[model samples]
Target: MNLVESEYQMGKSKIFMRESQKQKLDTQLHQTILSRIIVIQRWYRTIHQRRHFLNFRAMVVKIQAKHTAMSI
Candidate 1:
């Protein structure tokens, strides 16, 4: 079957499996969680980078306008 179905079967068979099977399942679960967390962190990093760039641009514009006003 599929990954989901396989995982479901593993869950249902938990009481019958050997120690090795349990460890394997746990390792798979950990890897899945870690990968998802990495994806989320990368997504947040990109969003923060974009926001920082926009803020920097805004500050630059404000500073230029202030200098122009002072010169006028």
Candidate 2:
């Protein structure tokens, strides 16, 4: 009976340790994913800004061209 009790305790300890390790791993994974999302969002914002700038520049050029034609 004593040996059986000791074995059970050891098994329980192992299970607890495994669960703790898994929780830590999950937390780390969540943080890494969050960081990646932030980086992607920043990159997307930069691309959007660049596109907007290009569109604004194009409009300015078109407006200038129209003015020149009117002057001629």
Candidate 3:
């Protein structure tokens, strides 16, 4: 941490940074949270789509089975 003397202050038990540093930290935290949310959303969409495809395939199979039984 490059603490310029003017950019920070050291009190008896606390260290304070300038507004610019605080803003930079806030931006980084928000970006990290948003990236994690994107990953979770992508994973959930993949699982939901796969389940929907499986259901559709099962319905098609059932329809084919009924058609074959009627022919027999």
Candidate 2 lDDT, tens digit per residue, 1-72? 112332233453464334555566678889999999999999999999999999999999999999999999
Best-matching candidate per TM-score: 3
Q: Poorest 10 consecutive residues of model 2 by lDDT?
A: 1-10
- CA lDDT of each candidate? 0.79, 0.76, 0.89
Regarding TM-score, does 1 or 3 come out ahead?
3
Off by over 4 Å in 3: 1-15
How many steric overlaps does candidate 2 have?
0
Model 1: lDDT to the true structure? 0.79
Measured on C-alpha atoms, candidate 2 has an lDDT of 0.76
Q: List TM-scores for all candidates, in order.
A: 0.69, 0.67, 0.75
User: Model 3 scores what on Cα lDDT?
Assistant: 0.89
Error of 3 at 4 (Å): 7.6
Report how far off residue 58 is in candidate 1 (Å).
0.4
lDDT of 3 by residue, 1-72 (tens): 444678778899997989987776788889999999999999999999999999999999999999999999
